[model samples]
Target chain A: MSLLGGGIFKGMAVTLRNFVGSYFYKDRLTTNDYSWRPSDKLPQHAGEYPKEEGEQLRDTTTVTNYSRNFPMLLHDGSEPMDTIRCVACQICERECPPQCIYIEKSTEKKENAGGKPQFYPAKFDIDVSVCMSCQICVEVCPFDAIVMNSQFELSTPDRFGGLLLRRDDLLKSNDYYHNIHPEEAAARDKRIAEEKAAKEAKKKAAAEAARKKAEEKAKADAEASEGTPDIQEDAE
Target chain B: MSLELIRDILVATVPLLLIFPTLFAFTTWLERKALARIQNRIGPNKVGVPLTRYGGRFSLFGLGQPMADGIKMLFKENIVPRDADRLFHLLAPILALIPAMLVLCFLPIDFPWINNIQDSVKAFMLDGAVIFFFAITGLNTLAVFMAGWASRNKYSLLGGMRAIAQMVSYEIPLVLSAVIVVMMVGSLNAAEIANAQAGWNWFIFTPWGLAAFIIFFIAALAETNRSPFDLPEAESEIIAGYFTEYSGFKFALFFLGEYIAMFAISGLAVTLFLGGGAGPGVAALPWLSVIWFLVKIFALIAVMIWLRGTLPRLRVDQLMGFAWKFLLPLSILNIFIAGSALHLLAGGRLAGLDEKQPILRQLMEGANPLVVAGLWIGALLILYVAANGLNQLSRAKVRPREYKYAE
Candidate 1:
């Protein structure tokens, strides 16, 4: 009889604990809709969210200033978000399994008088409905223009039109991108600036050398036209 | 003819009937979620949208998934093996499924009779419900054999043999445990047994009652071919076992039957050990009894899911050894103890005890605490030793022998 009582009590205790505990944690764990809220802070990368107070301080102040080559932590500070290393290459569009990504190359316009076209992506769109979230687009993107976001709560009505995000919807400012993926963005910006500076320096050195060579040639021509062939006779 | 009475019956049954299927659907979701958690991953979060009528935006993927799975099974091309017995092949799934659903008819989810029922006819009868439940469950083995033999496949044959072996081994313990309850209550009716256990006197609170409950639970697990004992359809050893040759909706019928069987057996456990629909002051408010009953059933199902997630499947011979050697003997002992207690109570040797006092009260009054604790500890130790011994013995028997070269 005692055996039976103990067993029943033990079982009851387990369930009672669970029920009571759930009630106590209701405020933190409840999935009710009224609790959800949006914020202005940039979403943290996949695994790089701050943990300790010290880590949070480092993440907010120091980590955000690091260059693009540095790994960006995502959601739990466990997954690395390697962004900004994109070369603007269109390989991701071609390899997308769901064909959700659309990219339009910037083309120079002959009709309009203009400087050399730097970048032109007129209409970039991604249909989130069609996207399988396989991360294939992220994998194949040469310029790393597209990335997998940890923002999973994308519920909407009307499957066809509501889920299709245009360029405006997907676009983030450079500062916002850096804040989310600090280390990677900083590294990329530094690399781009270094490459541009190196190209300019090379061009300037070549032009200076050419100018000196032309001046020397002009002096020789003028001296030849002057008819100064008696230099050796005067020395004798 | 009264509208209120009709509404009451409809309200009662609609919930009872819906409870099974709704739990079945949720069980599918829960199983996936639990398995994913065990394996360190997320599962089915993308299905049906959250906080919406149609479900959240991403929820369509999750919601449509089950529908898509069903349609795929429905449209799949059915293939019949050339050498298979066609008649039995067609009949087996139906046979398996029908009994699974039929047993629910005897299951009393609410009051025995609604207020509007003519006094001549009882809306529900709990009398002989135990025997009826056992009889239907007994037929499951036959369906399993039919499926195995009809397929004409070696794996199917092996699976069928295992099922028969398991069912035979567990059936003795299952029935013996129930006999303990019957002897105490002096009635075969589930509702009567429940009524006998009013207030805090649920059968699970006594010496024999505890033993019987454990024995019954373990036996039921084996009977349902659930995890640890689910050697028949061991995916690693025999892919899908008896139903390997079955395809399309025919195969789905078997799947559905298994889950329904699981629900039925869990319901039976609730009826036997947990006092069925008898809760505090529940006789007056019978409706609350059903709710209490369902809460217990769902809790049991959750435990089943947890067990499935946590444990690996047991080997075939290990399963048989556990049932025949351990559960059978323990359950038999439990019956004897219950019989002795009943005899003592009936003879009036124990004072201040009503013969009709629930099992819980009898245990609280009559049993020696020290002896009870010793017996329980001893039983647990014995079970542990027996399991390890059998595991070793099986290993030794199956060990590969090295061949000696002739001199």
Candidate 2:
């Protein structure tokens, strides 16, 4: 019923189309020439990549929104320590599958971004060599403090010192996060805002309920005092 | 041995020796570029002219990559196993190169200098060049086996055995398919076959030749170890097969020999099917035949590269079955069809027409156009149905693949 060797022609056709299409269609050729300098898409928020060959981040990337590698701590202001979101609860450290995260809670509390006294990590280190890039730490963090970073050019000569990323290296601005992962960062921010609004509403309701209870208690006391006076009158 | 005889030989042969190796180098670059393009990736575009690496300046589209590769291969350490057969290991690559080089002489390229050379002195212009080509080409198998045996490694031995099994199996169909051309031309000489197809009278225009060409091309792919049939050197299975133990210039020689073999086979294909050196502008400029021949050879090589990029290497059993059960039967049927077509369409020509005249010309000149057309159509139909029937018969009964470990 079928033509013999027809499949070969069909396969050859597909390859021929691919061979021809690649020259005309830009998207077909996805590889970026890494040897070339800064693609315009880069330096959006991270600044110019290091000029040195060894320290240079990949100047061009086809990294999409969901592409993630390693975990980084998020902050909002001029100083990372002052505006950091992590309260050093060690929740991520406990939940990490690979046990790559290391955190030491500060002896004293400090004022965080929310104006709440929170314990910051005195020592936060992520052994990138050990980290599996599973994003479990991202999932476990309750404070929205840690998120996956797509910056994969983390190679270093000194395996111990270089791969064990410190607090300073892990800390990245929220703006940089939004720049790299716009949709996800925006959604996270909106979720946090909604939770804050709900908390404020809950606090207001609790205060109103407390005020109503106090008013009822005071009225009951006044009525009892009035009933006692009436009893005295009756006695006289 | 005399000076004039030596001169005449050099005139005929030296260009072949020089031109093909250079083409081999360029073909390496071409294959990489083509395969990369097929995969939608840039290949070898970084290594351009030397001293251009500073500040990431100047890339000449990676043309220098082949030269760089050649230099690296030359300088690399020639490591041999202590237990290896040192003599054969050293000789295997040399042995591989010799036959591939020898077969190049058999191609009917019509090189320009041949006009001045004496007919007796021209070794390539042989009475049985076609047969000689097949005979010499089979020697590559021996070289492959030698390389494998000499290496004293299990993987190399496996590769060598696979190569022998594959090449021997495929060569049957390869030669069988060509027998149709030889039959039609009434000559085993490469030059005669090429001459028979002059002025767009390619034998492939006939239904039988079409079938034989396809069969020949497939067998050629297996014979040369081109992919989809490259089980002998299946890197995943045998770690580069027979060449696993070879390194440095010895390895380079093997690589060179393989590419030259590819070129030689492609040239033969052009001679047999595509009307060897028969192209436009050849009538006016005789030298253009050589160029056209090389161009056609490159076209086939390009297809080989494209197929290599597209198809996965075949399993050994599947490879053998396809060659033996599928291709062998099909090629045999093709020969039968060609004999019948010749009898039906050009019966008188086969018996009494001048043998020197092209078969296509004789058939056309002697017969009515409508009768010829009807016979050609009928022949094509019969060949197609027979091929389809063969395809159905040879297909494996298994519907889907079952992995033993995964399940």
Candidate 3:
């Protein structure tokens, strides 16, 4: 009798929940995508798009299209491609375990030809197929050349043709990068500004030292011409 | 074919087919939600958006999670372990799923989706559905074995062995319990059994009917490999049991099969005990019968989920002991009682034997009150002792101590 009571009550509790849930969450109760409801209001950032002036955004907010980090959310919330953080560093390419990454560094005809922006990556490619998403490249990148993008919906029928990403696809502006990762971007910007200020100060000190040396040389030449430096030379 | 009948069959079957997959999906969601609730967390909330523009911004919590999962599996690199039985590994998940899907064929959803199919020789009409349902469910064990053997892994092999033993052992009680049901109704057809339980005479409400329902429910739980009977797939022990080596769409197929089997068992339980699709005062309104059937299935499914959340997995030896020593004997006794009661009912031996009989008829009835009371009291005492013993035994078996590798 106890066994019967426990089992019956336990079973009844479960059924009661389902019976109640069926009414409140009816859309979820069925297998079909009945949760879809179209709306007329455009996306919040619709005004930002210059090309779509006065045009309404299509409401595709179906249950099927919802995702936590949806691609649409990424587009609307952040500009992820703004920062030119890559400094033609080959570290990301070297550390990529899959060898999916390729980089062509900019080269000059002459070595040590006055600091004229010595290096730039001329070509870059990341074969997403072979890339295992291990984040090794991102972790090892010294100049932060690569980072994992949250846009995961990269489905395409022609796998071979559509998956490989070129430099153009990878390239993003500093503003976009700041928008997506604001905290990291702010910290990086402060660090870079400090380094630039230090470099300018060092350059100013060197120029001042050079000017002092030239002035001493001119004074010595004038003293020789005038025979006035002979007393100090004899004393030394 | 008469157009009305054809339409009826189509409508009936389409919902049934749709319900199967829908329940499968919902079960996945329900499991996640329940597990999350137990762990004090939210699960799968990022799947979809709110239907209305002004409604509190909604997301299905990754409700399209299963879709994404399916797509990922489809596109994933399918790797077969080098040491595995390649042919069997490739064939196992499909083998497991096909029989599960096939079981849905005999299920009657509502009235004939097409009433005309009754006359069509080529229509999907299962004459002896009870036997067919049992035969197919039995075949599911073979698929489990194939999965274990194909993997070439020790954990999987052990899991397979446990599953086969557990299922084979429980099959007796399960069949015997249903045998009593069939004996009482004098029919092996599921629909007939359901029809027999019409009105308030639902089998669960009767003395023998209640016993059979309890026995059937326990046996069904064991048969489905659900917890405390879920030793076969005990995660801590077997690492996903027989499917350790499977991945991608193959893994999904195994998952789909398990849920579908769960669905079938729930449907079976409802049909056998809780009056299948029969509703109170619902015979007059035929359309409401389908709704009643769905309600029962969902209720049963919810119970399975709750059990999963509440119970711990039973150890292999303990599980076998419980099945053989307790459930088996109880089920056999239940059958005997049912058989005797049914025989008496058929022969009208118990008719007019009650205290309500007239004075002149009472002497002719010749009912023995002491014997009846003794039998009832004896049965009650046995049940009480068994319940207390089980409780004490479970409590005495303290949880295993956790081993730490380092400080």
lDDT of 3 by residue, A1-236 (tens): 24424664675566556545654664435432223236444222312222233344322222112111111101111333222345567887788788988888767321211223445556777787787777777667655456554345466687876787777776655555455555555676687577778877777776666666656765787776865452222110
The positional error of residue B326 in candidate 3, measured at the CA in angstroms, is 1.0
RMSD (Cα, Å) for all candidates, in order, is 11.9, 6.4, 11.1
Residue-by-residue lDDT tens digits, candidate 3, B266-360: 78788878887888658788777778887898787776777776667778887787778777777777766655544443345544344222221
Which consecutive 10 residues in model 3 chain A have the weakest lDDT in total? A67-76
List ranges where model 1 is wrong by over 4 Å. A1-236, B1-19, B29-84, B112-128, B152-154, B339-407
Q: Considering TM-score, which of the candidate structures 2 and 3 is the better prediction for this target?
A: 2
Ranking by TM-score: 2, 1, 3
Q: Which regions of candidate 2 deviate over 4 angstroms? A: A26-39, A42-55, A58-68, A74-88, A105-120, A134-148, A173-236, B1-8, B42-44, B50-61, B75-77, B118-121, B236-239, B247-249, B309-375, B396-407
lDDT tens readout by residue for model 1, A1-236: 13323543565455445444544565432333221224443323323333332222322322333223211111112111122232234576688787877776546422111233234355566787777777666555544455544344456777877787765566544555565556666776587578668867776666666665655655675577765342211110
Instruction: Give lDDT tens digits, candidate 2, residues B143-170.
Output: 9999999999999999999999999999
TM-score for candidate 2, residues paired by index: 0.81
TM-score of the second chain, each candidate in turn, equals: 0.80, 0.94, 0.82
Give the better candidate number (2 or 3) by lDDT: 2
Report the C-alpha displacement of residue B79, candidate 2, in angstroms: 3.9
Each candidate's DockQ: 0.04, 0.48, 0.04
Provide interface RMSD per model, one decimal. Answer: 8.5, 1.1, 8.0
TM-score of chain A of each: 0.47, 0.78, 0.54
